[model samples]
Target: MNTNGLKVLLIDDTVMILQRLQSLLAEVKQVSRTESATSAEEALVLMDGYQPDVMVLDINMPGMGGIEMLRKLNVKQMIKPVVIMLTNNTFAGYRDECMRLGADYFLDKSRDFLMIPSIVEKVQERNVLQF
Candidate 1:
């Protein structure tokens, strides 16, 4: 893992949202690589090849939602990536469930989308400091 750069994986069913996030993260100096998956299954497959330092996941999708994916990750005890749940779901239940399931951060897609880059940058800075 490169402490200087963040390998970010974005999971969102909406192509526009994915593109927007990719474009936003591109401006951040700490982000070296970015990948997008429209589904949890696709994200899992992508993870096999590219282990991301941070993951931006959406709660609603065709199959295996973000919360369920977090549960699976917890059960498998996989490479414990820093998970940031970015979803349009505004329910407190969803937010609480995601946090309980191991989400490092939860943000509403409609209101907090712009915060992603700053959060990723902070995560990168923290990673660098840890070393």
Candidate 2:
């Protein structure tokens, strides 16, 4: 993948997590832009202007949770970006629900956070190969 300028949107309520993710994503060769939102509502608003190629989302938020957001996105047919649900919630139900709702990938924030960038890189490579 020529990851020269990939636009990535990260949605997480924790400021520290967001900052960490932003820094990690910045190091990826394919990542060019990184945007963040504290909640699903804020992410929705940001989406109007920034159509990210990839979205790293959290399952829990103040207003709309990641599952609800994914359902809404599916209903509206807004599934262009590869949605990766990154959350601390590791319940089977939550994982199953997210996958059914159109999340391309689901990762536990504590255990799988470090794997995100590599996953994104692989996704980018797959996308490039598809073309």
Candidate 3:
């Protein structure tokens, strides 16, 4: 996969969170496109039309939370996007659970929100080196 430009999918219940993350990622040259979904269910629907290279997900939602969505993605064998679980819940259980469920990165929304662009850039760099 060409990582020079990455397509990112942002899934969160909050509009502000989505907008903030989108704007932050927009500044990064590596990000070619971004799509946002207010819920995991909506994201799943969007996935049929868009295969993202990276997924920035929230752990908690009204229905079909991020963890459940991750399981569905694995079971369905969807295009394996690099999963980044970004949430305000920084509990150890959530972190471990997310990692076990195939999350590449688990970031605390409060402390790690600003690090997303750098993380995406690093993923792009790593993919470039892999090829």
Best-fitting candidate, scored by lDDT: 3
Instruction: For candidate 1, give the lDDT.
Output: 0.90
TM-score versus the correct structure, for each prediction: 0.94, 0.93, 0.94
lDDT of 3 at 96: 90
Clashes of each: 0, 1, 0
Question: What ranking emerges by lDDT with the best candidate at the front?
Answer: 3, 1, 2
Model 3, 18-91: lDDT tens digits are: 99999999899999899999999999998878888899999999999999999899888555999999998999
How far residue 28's Cα lies from its native spot in candidate 2, in Å, is 0.1
Q: Write down the lDDT that model 3 would get.
A: 0.92
Candidate-wise lDDT, in order:
0.90, 0.88, 0.92
Q: Candidate 1, TM-score vs. the true structure?
A: 0.94
Model 3 collision count: 0
Better of 2 and 3 by lDDT: 3
